[model samples]
Target chain A: MKRRDLIKGAGAGLLAAGTGIAAPAIAKGVKQWRMQMTWRANSPLLATGPQLVADYINKASNGRLELKLYAAGDLVSPFQVLDAVADGTLHMGHGYPAYWAGKLAAVQFFAPIPFGFTSQEQNAWFHYGGGQELADEVYGELGVKFLPSGNTSVQAAGWYNKELNSIESFKGLKIRSGGLGAKVLTEIGGVPVQMPLGEVPQGLQSGAIDGADFVGPFNDMAFGLHKVAKHYYWPGWMEPSAVLDCFINKEAWDSLDKDLQEIVKGANAMANQMVLSEFVTKNAQAVKIMKEEHKVDFRLLDPATLGHLGRVSQSVIDDVGQTDDLTRKVYASYRKFIDTVQPYSELSEMAFMNARAQLKS
Target chain B: MKRRDLIKGAGAGLLAAGTGIAAPAIAKGVKQWRMQMTWRANSPLLATGPQLVADYINKASNGRLELKLYAAGDLVSPFQVLDAVADGTLHMGHGYPAYWAGKLAAVQFFAPIPFGFTSQEQNAWFHYGGGQELADEVYGELGVKFLPSGNTSVQAAGWYNKELNSIESFKGLKIRSGGLGAKVLTEIGGVPVQMPLGEVPQGLQSGAIDGADFVGPFNDMAFGLHKVAKHYYWPGWMEPSAVLDCFINKEAWDSLDKDLQEIVKGANAMANQMVLSEFVTKNAQAVKIMKEEHKVDFRLLDPATLGHLGRVSQSVIDDVGQTDDLTRKVYASYRKFIDTVQPYSELSEMAFMNARAQLKS
Candidate 1:
């Protein structure tokens, strides 16, 4: 093979193995950039979002822009993706905005919060209700450009070894969880342990953690959590839905021509919706599989428990949203949007779901 | 200005007036196609979806593909879009599948059915649950290619003259509705009336039609339905959600290069999600506006009424699905998808929405 052909072939092979080594050929004005996702290695479901954007950008641009994709820790630590993209070491990074909440409290609203926006509502806010602009304002300070890139629509609450029949069922219980949800758990006298998601199944099996929240049925089943836990709970109060963050280094983004820029923008929007469709489809299948095959006992958190959790969550969100100026502004917008949309949502989406349920029951 | 520039300028002016005249310049491999939408003129919400796709395609292609778009009655009658696109008189067309169900019964499932798939569920089915393949198979017979282009999300049951408190309230009621929903309405002892959307307000004011079921609050308020009707009802059981159709003439599509083809696919996908976001945000705003300014009374159909409607809807959909072999196959796929997703949707979407309403109340 010719030297150039061999180099291109090796680059493609290494890229497939998640290696960041892309001595990428840049001939004939074809641009190349490295992109990495926060999703763990070889996760087909979560990685689908980033891959769709990368593939679309490449195909739609007719090979003008090539994005070399990597999974978490393949190029940099998942926790370091923000800083890497901000510093221009990485051209583009994909993850949830909630990961950066420590740097900007407003990020939580963009990602997930207890009983926060569902997939459709959160997406409406971003694309139509001024959310993308607010997000741009917040992320601009960090030298990053933001796009809503992916979604894990409405998760299951978690899996528990025991049925959570009442509010008191949470007291003295241990679960593997993190972020804002951990604080809410603490408030109810539940112990939130810090454990790797990879360790969750073993933790539950060994009685180290009595419960765990990964994603919905799709990812949970992938981790074999249902095999160890008896009760799968509902309403995913801690994370009703999550939108993945696509961050590009500001300097790198500014260098792209208008054609490539629009391709990236349009491709990311397509990815945003595609990811939700994937999750909803896969999660449903997992729920059915776990129910019929594994005999997993599914349960719902009772009204009293949900009500208590709701009150505590509101207080928590309010307290956190008051931390800084951006958070304050973002929270105001977020709060106003919810207040504006909730009544209609209650009548439309919620009412329809309830009616469907009533008919089925 | 040059002669070419003058022609281009005149074309732009005429196109802005919704004229189909594009005597479009196709110099330098720049492809130009006339596209028409079924949305009414000056209706911002519905038009936004098609406009987004056109703009994205033009910009992303960098003027290679100039999609000059027209509204209903501009280039052809709304009823003629499918025939236009199929026989190659019109290069492209955009509208709801329900509009063409008279030609092919399976089209209704892709558009709307009483107690049918909500926006998210419908999208998931199309993109992930084999609905799109079935759609392509059905539409391919008509010598056209199809894409899921837009969504209305979950609509309000629509405007009413009075509160519908029970199943009996629908008896003897006169409502302006169409398609499978109208069939279910007739089954429930309601008289379904035929009327143009432009005349609905006057008709409602004169009690010619007691109520009208239009596209949710966004389009409903645009037609001033809230002014003539005192009560708004919801769960939108008759038309839970509606997805718009983007169809291309088969020969025109086959002639496109791969890059332009991918752009079309990605742009349509983006359009599908954008319409939903636009509708959701605008519908919420309209609900707020009518509630405060017009004092519109919002009501919901009770459980028993919804149940009766649900049963009738099933029978209606079943009968239609049995009309042909393709529809029966399509219906089987849709039914299987609904069964796979509904249980999980109940737990996550419904339970979360219920918990949210409980908190707010």
Candidate 2:
């Protein structure tokens, strides 16, 4: 019954002209609502996961709630999704919390910060470690309901052109990165360019940027970054595990009946699982193909190199985390969670991984 | 909208007498179907996750379908769940695939094997990597529909009484374990004792077993293993990530309308995510408690000993995998998936973990 059909993007998702607003209307006997996502057309992990959420909600509601999806720039730009959803311009919008950092500093803490929580840790924090309560307090101020919808499990460090033997190798290099990772690069005297993922391949080939860390192998390979940059790197210290969130206007969310609300919540959780699985499965396949068929040279940043970056990352995070009162509270939670979970994760999953890796040829 | 409520196991889940048959009866204009689980009443990660699945299905269906849940031995024994579901004695059941290894050796591959796929990788394999198709072929023979419902993310190496410095330390010692882990223990001249997880604490206290590999810190701590054994070890090489599945009778599954079927599938996926997140969070909290409050001595098994265990494990798997044609096919798929996923996982998440661990105080 489960099929991996490519989600139709652009106009195909809606049978009727969408108002692109939060006010739901009763069409015949069904309730109609519009949803938008911060993803371009045919984007694999980003768009597909949200599309599944919309699909699940539409189907599981059994003609009660009909949710139509739109891609990034289909209704508005990716960065404006939060404001659009909050102001009732869109019923619901799916995007990364990091995209709203410029508007609210506290939101950045919810995104994947450098050397921060992994996907598993992030999920645990959101559900168990008082994260949802914190989210309610922070995002609730903007009249938006926040839900962790999807995650990009541990992205690749990125694609590179020149080999890195030292921290000095990063100086003056223009790299397309985002958030705390970008700040760390800036601290190291590298130019951090903020550009969309789709433009990265051309940027690297035409010398617009020396390097880029858009996403993991699956997404990076889709952009044809491997052809432009032979030295592909791993352990994306930039965004270890990015959590994608689904934002809904508080009024629109409150307007839904109890059963419809439950359907929406269940759809978000299902999409979270589906998104990570897709990333893990596709990244594995992509890496094997890039390595064996495309002759991409996969490189690891040495421990010393990573250590220097990690130090810079901590300082950058400290500056951002201390910007305001809400940011401080969120950072405290993140700090305690990481302090509690990291040691245990290292002993259990990380130790198992080291042992398993050695067993392989 | 999402809340974590303790699942009412045993009698509380049903309002009326359950027929425990696949033939759904109409009750107050709602279709009623009964489901049983391998978990006992009030089990944390195990029963709670599956109960949430039932709750989601119930609420999302909006009274169209009412699914009742039961705990282990409430309707039938834990080991009988598969057979009960297959024969339509139970409309649906939830349990690990390894429980039915005696009935069909091929089903064992679907469970967590020694040093096999991690939770993320396992999720990937089940969804992608042609695993579900293989499941349809393998489990379709048993008149049951299989869906991956939950997972225990990478368990601990388990608890031990004696310090493990060498392979000989395990010789002639009784350890409560099961599946391929038990087989590996037997290969190493250790007396493998099979018992329920709830019994591990009493067995260790009574000197019936010297050590036990019941589960990770969360469940094992719940069994009061920390009170029995001081030396808690790292990297459970036995069952890296065990996947718990929801099994539906072919007849019952086919009887559902398309919308109801989607609800069922969506609930399973949500449970899968919740289960792993609970494991990750609880294990982290439990380990911290065991160390600080209980003063449990956390230990690491040296790589040389793990290497030896891995070697025996492969041989044991080879013997079991070669037992029949279907098993061989399943084993081939497992091998291909691990070989493809492991290298990339090692370089990405594992590498980032090591780097992050080094950064912490």
* Stretches of model 1 off by over 4 angstroms after superposition: A1-25, B1-25
Considering just the first chain, candidate 2 attains a TM-score of 0.92
**TM-score of chain A, all candidates:** 0.92, 0.92
**Which parts of model 2 have CA positions greater than 4 angstroms off?**
A1-29, B1-29
Per-candidate TM equals 0.93, 0.93
Clashing pairs in 2: none
Measured with C-alpha atoms, the lDDT of residue B200 in candidate 1 is 88
Clashing pairs in 1: B157-B234
List model 1 lDDT by residue over B27-61, tens digit each.
Answer: 87888887788886557778887788888888889
* Candidate 2 per-residue lDDT over residues A167-229, each given as its tens digit: 899999999988878889999999999997778899999989999888888888887888898
How does model 1 score on DockQ?
0.78
